[model samples]
Target: MERRFEPPVDGRGAQSVSVPTRFGLATREADGDWRDYMEMLEGPPVKLRTSVVEEHPKTILTFNTSPDIGFDRSINAYRGCEHGCIYCFARPSHAYHDLSPGLDFETRLFAKPNAAQLLRATLAKAKYTPRPIAMGTNTDPYQPIESRYRITRSVLEVCLEARHPVTITTKSDRVLADLDLLTELAEHSLVAVAVSVTTFDPKLSGKLEPRAAAPAKRLAALGKLVEAGVPAHCSVAPVIPAITDEFMEEIVERAAALGVGSCGWIPLRLPHEVAPLFREWLSVHFPERGDKVMSIVRSIRGGRDNDPDFFTRMKPSGVWADLFRARFRLACKRAGLEKPNFELDCSQFRRPNVGGQLRLL
Candidate 1:
């Protein structure tokens, strides 16, 4: 292994000071071995800057037959997320492109500018069948960069014009920007949204998911979506043991107070590269409970950092898992929250004309 010294970035979640082993590949230091002592004497390290590259994928829709996931078809507007969440399961994906799943996963981003066009073409196929297309399943569609690219918005426009059913999951207030479109789709029973809330503590939230919407803002967004008649739900995702797990009931109760009738929760999952990244975060932020947290996580994951088996992965078992599930269920029941079961109407789908125009009669 080789080491290179780069200036540390500020306001980011992962304290990825050292690069981890590359996945299935050997890595050599890109820069020369010796550092310039004169440069180190200059000043403190500079922050890591984010960069975006335009990716023109051949196809936009990714199909999965995994029995655990709810949807079979989904779309990712971007390849890398700017939110910099240390526990993001999608971090390992960056390795396929030879990028670091640590800092690089957040700082280096890829935007699919032609995603909406490809989606339209795919939906227009003669054999195509309409189902609720899930967005933000892999990476958040409304991450900070969405404000600039607007690719997610374009996709929603296409879905609306075709009267296609769609489901969205996000942690950003940016979703509110598309209220007009979502409201229209809601009227037709064609849309549902879930806002993920990890913790209400602003400090913990900032450390866990740097640059994403604050917890309060996310709750507010969920309230706004529900007020607009969209089938909005609260997602208490990745409930970390010895950390954010305590907030599960609080999140559910708050969402219920905001008129959100449905809720869901997922135990924290540390697949592949995410495990080390999360460990680094824990050491930096909560050193005292880091080991205890991992102990519980391993117990839930069958003595491993992760459980890759399809069904078992989704259904985390063990004492901690059972306890967490029980608490979440009791909280939801007390709050009068029901598990969301809003089925989007697919009968209204219509293939737009070749010129990307919808013929409304």
Candidate 2:
């Protein structure tokens, strides 16, 4: 018989600590039965620890033909994000590996230590045609663990050597550490970077994106990118209804002030397991307005928790969506920000010379 599962409760200080049985077998709660009695006899709840496992995949490049996005190929140096944003759409992907889309998505991480080597081999293929490769599309390439692993940096080095065009999207200030490589890529018209900023409220940001860099730090990184002549853009993404929608104008305005060339927004999406996870998050952080917020969201999503259609998912409709769009457009106009037109030069791509020798054509 198919097992039924209920939405899991948020842990005292963590988001969705226990795995829900919705995907498969029904299991007892972490604190149920004997554990519940023991907890009553003891004091606080048990802490969930994070674990990292290294994976050496046969290949590292992921290619897609989706119409919703611009790039055809992308790379993700990590499988799970440590930033722990409650609204992450990629969380559901973890379920395919028999992992929880809740706390397990954040605590149990995977790294590709041989990513650079694999990417180098892939790009050096004799029939490989050049196109701008994208990074951080599925999971953050520069998550906290990146500092120790430096896998993303290694991939960049490979791109730099090959004169390959690349685009990056990230919410961490950690990208700033690679400013030197970014600057070089800019000179060759081979790079574009988008920094995502959801809101300026530190408290709300902390609650929503527990481990991401602060709003100010992200803005500063954008500024630094622009100052270094890198094509920097701002992403005011996943605009939550009745929660962070109000900050649409402010985020765009701040990003423009930082010299961002373009800005875009994505409405909140709760696909599959994300719907329940997000609902639980809402109840915990915005109990007073959780229902009202979901109501507005549903109204815009055709009276449903989410819209999975590609075109509709990118373009939300409704009174609230119209208002937010108007505000965003006006702010962009006032701040002199325009849609990004700069494209990375694909014709300049060259395979890196192996063994310190020149390729004889």
Candidate 3:
């Protein structure tokens, strides 16, 4: 049997604590010595810290024609997320940088400082057609580093200046920091925000998404967005069976109570390296139900670790699927949550005054 890597665990009665798991590292550091195994057993005395590298790309807007997803274009201010959600599907993209899809996906990050400028140039193109530009499509735009870099905020400023419609999907309450911009966009029907709430249990949330905002904070953020007249939607995303599924109803009820008119859930998706990393997470965090969790996951994922097919991937089948579907349907109905009709106003978009393209009606 291969030796398992153990992450640091904090003392329960400790005043302050930080636990970082090595479940999924985008790339492993090259071994300089055979004593690495000895070092592992002894454990490091210090906590792991995050490192960022700035990337300057010619283009900032990315486009895809995936039929299942709602948006066709998106902007990712950062290349890697620090949230450390073991189930994140975007982890595989790190391999392009000679990185693995595990812990490296969270700790070693890339930021595009020129994102706002590139976005402005892209929008100034005469041939550019306006559609809702989705933010937070790959990694959380409001991740911890956003406060320092403010790249996402810069991108939004460009959107506001261009009158370009934009949508945000985030797990951080930091979106509230741009309430002024968001409020103005909402007034013009140019923005909509969706906040993903995984589970209401803080302990489980810490174990699953160690760096994400607390569940309560996410709900409060959603409430604040709605109260500020921003079109907000709550998603009980990646509802892990026998794990996070238990909190679906409660999450929905809370969202509904917060004046959130729209909410839904997504089943767990274990694409690429995410599957192994999540399994490792389960073995370390919930060894008792690790097998059970995978069992239910496979059952709903067409009897495999994941269903990669387009339509079927998002829409699971069989009795277990039906049960989750029914439960979510009833929960939404009971909570008076209805599907939100958030059609961003693309007609209001105007080319930004850049690249020799002056603002023209």
Candidate 4:
């Protein structure tokens, strides 16, 4: 295998690794010894790689007309993620660009350096009406790269200037860097934030989401955002059944204690490529529980790896789903939390170009 490295950028090496995509079967020795040296030779290293690309998407604002999600429009400042969460559903999206949804989805990343400028141009159009624009709906806006690029911050600067309503969702404490801006936006009922957290187990967190902030740090971030006057809620999204479900109540209680008024949970959905990638990840890290975990997932998914129907996709079916719903609702009751108040005021929207032509109220 050939390898090359570029000079360090932002303290992280800009080295790239590329591998041809292929498939293989899962097998072990007759003695059930997984670590036997010869077993290693059966599957070759796929040479996972990375490459840095500067992107400029035509439109920074993505209008989603999907009935499944609550928000109608969203923006992603970056593509491909650095956090490396094994169960990330966004993984399959990379395949559209002829990129592997495995390592390439994390290591081979792209950053849109001009997203803020594009957003400003978009909002400046005369016919454009204002509404709450959602961020971090796909790739995180506050990922590690934000510290240096600050693309998300620049987008928020435009939103602030336009008096546009904005909602943010992220797993990084880096959002704290924009506290002053968020505070000002909140005053006009124009801003809210959601923090996605799966579990409080540090060990599982390290292996599952390799580069994300520690669970403790995320909880501390929740507290800090609340204290700083940001309307923050806790989101235990894509909760893997049988793995992190056991901690549902504890997560809710912790968020409530930290002054988070709302909490919600979603069962893990392995749409398309995520199912295989997550299975590979399971075999590598949690071999013993891999089968059981997938079994429960199938139970909730109605004997399939995924259910893509609009309303039912987010809320699964079968006895397992019932049990999860019962447990989640009971936990929310005990923690004194309610379904999050996600509504934002859309009437306060202002288009910079229309102000001079005044109208009689």
Candidate 5:
């Protein structure tokens, strides 16, 4: 195996690991090139700057038939997540573009600037059926770049105009920017937002999801959403065993205190290239217990770095799994929280106008 390349990109989850693309393709590696030399000429190491390449596609909706997934369709406005979560299952997706799922996945990104228009076109079809369109399903729609691109807000506007039902899953407080749209949708029970809180420790969260909103900010976003009458769900996602599991109770308690309607947890999932990258991350950040962390992970993963089977993939087994379930159940009970309800009303959906068409009031 070729050794993974380490890059000096500040504010990244995997500080020194970039697992090469598994797909057989020509990939660029840092070869003490100009960027590396810039470190010597400059005071500190050269940082990897974020770049975006636009893609124009006929359709913006993606359909999946997996039994466990809740929704049938989703929209991914961005290809790679800038959050650079070390354990993101979606990291492998960048390999298809001949990019490393490590640093490349965070710095080199693809944006669908025309996604809102494409989504409008799809919803305007005469035979179009209304179902909850999911955003942030693959790559988060409200990552840092969203403030400038505003693609997510544009999509929300289209949904609001069509009276379409939509669900947003994000890890950024930037979702608060569209509170006006979400507030209106909630009035009709057509929208739900799930904010994923990984950990409450700021330092740990910074290391885990580098560019995502801070834990406090995410919790505050949840509070604001619930206060605005928008259906809010606090997703204690990818609870890292031995690292973040300790905060499960605190997170649930805080969510309940904030008047959050629902809450849930998803165990850590290391899929494909993410496993190696995460192992490297563990070695760097938690050298003392890296072995122990992987041991617990493997125990729950059926003696592997990951579990990829359907049904069982999302539902991890083993004693560790049982312990986690019981702990989360107790946490929710103590916090007066319930399993999140993502179902929203789709009956109010009206076909959006296409091209230059206008609707009569």
Candidate 6:
């Protein structure tokens, strides 16, 4: 007769700190291993992290009713980001899926493999109005996996086919890979690209943005984009006080040197889940300066970790914000990096009708 074995259980079954347990029948001991008789006793349940399959959104265009942004609509090719910036403002988005906004946010990523097909279908709609569609708003379109998925490239192809205007914002030098397509779009007045440079210092960049392209590579990409005749601009985002804020002048100067036509800077914002994550990161990377860094951040955030109000979120209030503005203005003045002059023309918009005028023709 066969015997059944029960799994060893810890203290509490439901509320126990450890995982679930099961039991198995003990068998005859053979070799020196005494546990072999237990067959396959249930010890601890192996946590299987499941990746949910999300339907490919048929319509690629998304409306942004929020007044905080300059554009009304945008598109993201991927869901979770692999960049793994501890201070990333988009981290909280993972909570919607019951996933940890920490390591899981970086590791378990999702890409919209059908983004190009959706873009084409959306653009082909007769009622679809053409506006400069923004890319890389929530997560970077050129993030690491973009190389394999090539979703961004496909989206660009759709925009090019429709002669639709596009404005891209990214921190990856991988944007250079789309140079030929971008140059073609530029000739038709259909494209603009902004490369975000948080800090020119490599060490600071290493901690703030773990998997992002090197700062030097971003600068080099800026130069390359400009040389390719694509309207290129520099954005120094989330400028932290007493830290990267000090490099404002140098960043502007270097941008101008790279032939970047325009430059902009935004004060640091540690909103939602980002504040604590950033604190943890700072504690690990710059333990000595962690407290000081949070103190300065609080000073700008009105003694809080974050300010969610639209006006205050992008550019914080108080002395720190004022100082940042003054320094940025002075630096831009000195570097001759005037405000971005690239204004996408909406007047030329035309939805190529099915049997009417073929745009490319």
Candidate 1 is scored at a TM of: 0.92
Q: Rank the candidates by TM-score, best first.
A: 5, 1, 2, 3, 4, 6
* lDDT by residue (tens digit), candidate 3, 199-271: 9877677667767887889999999999999999998998999999989899989999999879978899988
Better of 2 and 4 by TM-score: 2
Best by TM-score: 5
User: What is the alpha-carbon RMSD of candidate 5 to the true structure?
Assistant: 3.8
lDDT of candidate 2 vs native?
0.81
**Superior candidate under TM-score, 4 versus 6:** 4
Least well predicted 10-residue stretch by lDDT in candidate 6 = 11-20
Cα lDDT of model 4 by residue, 236-332, tens digit: 8768977898888898999999999799887898877778667666765677999999999999887889988887788788888899899989999
Query: In model 4, which runs have C-alpha deviations exceeding 4 angstroms?
Result: 1-50, 352-361
> What is the lDDT of every predicted structure here?
0.85, 0.81, 0.81, 0.75, 0.84, 0.72
Candidate scoring better on TM-score of 2 and 6 = 2
State the local distance difference test value for candidate 1.
0.85
| RMSD (Cα, Å) of model 4 | 8.6
lDDT of 1 by residue, 1-361 (tens): 4544334344565564455645553432222111111123333434545789998999999999999999999999998887878889998898889887777778789999999999999988999999999999989999988999999999999999889999999989999999999999999999999999999987677678877888889999999998999999899998999999989999999999999979999999998878877887787779899999999999999999899999899998989899999999999999998878998999999986657876776
Per-model TM-score on C-alpha atoms: 0.92, 0.89, 0.88, 0.84, 0.93, 0.82
Model 5 agreement with the true structure over 1-361: per-residue lDDT tens digits: 5675464444566555446557864645543211221233234544565789888988999998999999999999999988888888898888887788877787788889999899989998998899889898889999888888999998888888888899999999999999998999899888999999989887788778877888999999999999999999999998889999999989999999999988999999898888888888887789899898899899998999899998888888899999999999999999888787767888888888887354675
Flag regions of model 1 displaced more than 4 Å.
1-9, 21-47
Off by over 4 Å in 3: 1-46, 355-361
What lDDT score is found at residue 311 in candidate 2? 65
Model 2 C-alpha RMSD vs. true structure (Å) is 5.4
